[model samples]
Target: MHEPAHARVPAQPLIPAQQKVLRHSVRGQVLDALRAALVDGDLAPGEIYSGPALGERFGVSATPVREAMQQLALEGAVECLPNRGFRVLTRTARELAELAEVRALLEVPVMLRLARTVPVSAFESLRPAAAATAGAAAAGDLPRYADADRSFHGQVLALAGNDQLVQVAEELHRRAQWPLPGAARIRRADLIADAAEHSALLEALIARDLPVVESLVREHFAGNPA
Candidate 1:
């Protein structure tokens, strides 16, 4: 992603309180936090990130920081430099479009099949994911909203019983998450509409309406119908 015109480093980097380590939080938890930070724009795209600095922010040693970043690199979220650290990598517009196409091809089929096969009762447990998405959207919390978006979609796809499929779909989803042009200027209406779609999609699924489910899935990419 291109740097925003007004981009400037903050006066102070985030420093998580050491006392906040409540109960030996694992590396996965740290990874989740870092991922959320990226989605929330707490970590700017195109910025260089050092493991030690991030370690300080997370109140942990550099090892876990590096490890977590390594995982992100594998997922194409960041690129590591030998002597330096990692650079956040956002897909170009064309690249994101291609990914969206591929994602729709893969995601839509599974969704359609599940709509016809899975009982509506099986989806009752997914209410929380949908609710979280609505809550995040209503509050305009991008990180929380993005994570909930993933949860709702992932849960929907899990009926396929393919862990690898979910992982790949998630990678593509993350790539499409870079801030749009004038991201800070995004309107409340857009966010509300985006969040509301989750509930609509869920209702479509529960109703076993394959056609509506397919359309909703395609529109999840927003204006890029597959």
Candidate 2:
């Protein structure tokens, strides 16, 4: 028999050094996308996210997708499966109720301090973000509206004059987004109503009505969500 021809081998694909940087960038992008999906309710609680499918969706390899899922798991946004995959973490209705209660307690009192300390000038500064929220509500961009809604709260928090309270509220607001999907639609009416409240709070502040501001803050959270 004729000697077999030497087997030809294909050269290995070379990933350049810059590929590592690209991989990191891809990982970051994947992280942000998954986070947004979670916040927007596109990734529902208890739903499985396939690493391969996520990789395909973002036009990346599974490595970055897996990495992003792991990070989200650490944040409690998702949970890892044993030898299977990851699933979105669910917050029970009871847990949501408790969070709402805590938010009311922490944030409303903080707003009381802010309403008292916020200058009339700061009210003018808040108008634009407030307007953006109103516009988003009109346009039916619930996520943008949520952002604007949160921004309005942030402006109030900033005026509280307590750096630590502001920081804690800011962080809690981020986590709060997870439970806000259903509330987003409810907030269409809420934003309009809240705009009025914000205006009223400012007016009360200008008038130095501490009781009125406290009442408004309490009312705001009390009616937030069940």
Candidate 3:
């Protein structure tokens, strides 16, 4: 029961506070598909994607495409222009290194504290994220892998019971995942190794091996080699 390709589903711009992560809506579906395209390199970095063209590709009107692009803009994934469409933003090696440094400084200690404070059983509920990351890596699906990675880390920080800390971690994490200039060069094996880190970290957390967990967390961020 889907709408026709020519259907013109209208879209409305959302205010900052009202903005929710796109999910379960027509625009949200478009948003997910578009993100996959970006991650798969179907949409090259530094390239511009016109709203109408993208809409046609997704079999909708331009509204949802534009709406999704706007959301991507907020993620620091793209820059929207007045007369032109959105331009994919590129990052430098130094910038990516700095992002990792900031996350190491901000999140490593928080994860360690949470690991120590929360019971091992508290983290058992989050196993699905690790599973999802593994699945995505097996399929070489970068977009799904990124989403699951974000969810896994975000959940770990949320266990610390600090909304503000989670917010900061999420922002920095999203920026760290940006399609840097070297992103296209990453291989499936690299992503699989990345996924393995999550699994290893979770095993340490569940074992209540605080020292090992702390070391794993620090090592993971030391080089987001993915």
Candidate 4:
């Protein structure tokens, strides 16, 4: 006897209250949801966010919402109004281009430096992250794909042996996540193509080829074509 069509499908993960709290951390969940909302243009730039209103949307209370907003303000993703509330921050094309340029500036040199020094062990450490990124892309999970991308780049920065650069990369990477919503729509082919680039970078690093690694770094930071 054949199983029902729906029965053949994978079961969804259960979201128990304890698991929900663990996964979301209350504040991080609120922050990420609000950030996604802002980046997706659901909350237009300069639009005031009411804590109670936002809490209602998330089925929580204002405390978490306010905490999220304050975090966003620190990240420059939102602005706080004294008598009003929080407003989404907008970015222009030129501003985004500049941000990418900055990433290139910090990243390319570090990758080049790492390429010269990366041991076989360090290069091997990146294989899991690369595989995970490819898996996320294959699954068409944009957020997970992006997170894996961050992880891959972060491992590279950490391998460079510069704590300050690693910190800088983390901060910049967080800001870069803002542009991803529109960029993802524009470069729909990228998530797949970008996965391949990670492979090239990994191979170049393993080979200890500084020039090839630098070139690959430039290609990776150049952004994806729509």
Candidate 5:
């Protein structure tokens, strides 16, 4: 006897590549959402959040949420608790200063070097990212501002042709942007000033003004909190 149509037409399982792509997509979404929450102060530092709870909040399954949290843990943004959940790590003022110092150490020289050698078009290309930061700052969108800020800096460093330097500098940038418990929230004015500095720095780079570029980069790392 022949099987029924529904039984005969069995669903095709996803191939390994497709499955991997899907998993990575979901993981990336969850990670972005989690980072946005962290930046916007929606996820309080020192507060523990369970994967299932955050999954429900993000409209995904616990698997992706846990994966995102694990990545965050590796980034020093959170800590994994045995049988509990992930806690947003509270950073001290000293820790933030140190991160800023390290980032400046890694990036300032690159910016100075790129200023002398990289073409004007390369720096000009980053204008949009700089503008995005300004817009986000004006709108008080902390998450967008943070992402744009990182993108601008990363683009600047990428011109140096050192992928490792870009990665390390961006990691430090991300760590520096994390919220500190009991600390005053970064004001909109501060964000705007920081964003404006990006434009100034871009202009200096495009003009190949090494002295101005170095000063702007150093001041930026010293003053920018997010």
Candidate 6:
């Protein structure tokens, strides 16, 4: 069956499952890179990026980059420009405020409920995630800080034992973090202050201080601008 050495298949070939896994791995890596670029302002708002160009930048095929851009479009981070490409959207303060309101409506009550019933040990366990945000902020690493921030919140909400709620809340959280055009750059001091609130909220949760938790939660959402 080996008509020519050059035409012969490799001794070990990737199975269908393995191929799918490899594809997913590449797609995930591309997606993370795109998200990091967005957070770092490397992909500026209102910029138009084609899949091929992004693929060249990330050293992958256009497929994964386009897939990642599609996901970003679904998350409201970008707008699909028909046959052209994707345009990074500039988030408005009003849009961000609306998102904050929705997140507050969903999470505040759940957090308060969990504070009253969940064990203090559960809150204690999330301290490391909370601390990670502070470290990321200290380094002025916005992408890392964003990830740590989301992880900290996700961990806190996962205590409710509702996967659907966690997914929806996280989606909203990501949308709120998108960059705004003409807005002042986020200062490291501001990031540090915001990161500190995570620990403060955790402390209130551990203490079972309902009023303090509610106040902190509301203020946290209010102070955040998109």
Top candidate on lDDT is 5
Give the lDDT of residue 130 in candidate 3: 82
lDDT of each: 0.73, 0.64, 0.74, 0.70, 0.82, 0.81
Q: Which stretches of candidate 3 lie over 4 Å from their true place?
A: 1-24, 182-185
lDDT score for residue 125 of model 2: 75
Q: Higher lDDT: candidate 3 or 5?
A: 5
Model 6: residue 221 alpha-carbon error in angstroms: 1.2
Please write out the lDDT profile of model 4 over residues 91-183, one tens digit for every residue.
667766777789899898888877777687888888999998888778766666767888888987898777898888877776766653333
Off by over 4 Å in 5: 1-21
Please tell me which model should have the higher lDDT, number 1 or number 3: 3
- Clash statistics: count for each candidate: 0, 0, 0, 0, 0, 0
Worst 10 residues of 6 by lDDT: 2-11
**Per-candidate TM-score against the hidden true structure:** 0.82, 0.70, 0.81, 0.81, 0.88, 0.88
Per-residue lDDT, model 5, residue 162, is 86
Report lDDT (Cα) of residue 25, candidate 1.
Answer: 56
lDDT of 1 by residue, 1-226 (tens): 5422213322232335445553335467667777876665666667778777777666677777788889888877778987678887755668777877998999989999888888887777788888887887788777777788887888888888999999988888876776543346345466678878888988998999989999998888755211
Q: RMSDs, each prediction?
A: 4.3, 10.6, 7.5, 8.8, 10.5, 9.5
* Ten contiguous residues with the weakest lDDT in model 5: 2-11
Per-residue alpha-carbon lDDT of candidate 2 for residues 91-138, written as tens digits (9 for 90 to 100): 766665665567778876666665566677876777776677668666
Deviation (Å) of 9 in candidate 1: 8.6
Task: Arrange candidates, best lDDT first.
Answer: 5, 6, 3, 1, 4, 2
lDDT for model 1, on a 0 to 1 scale? 0.73
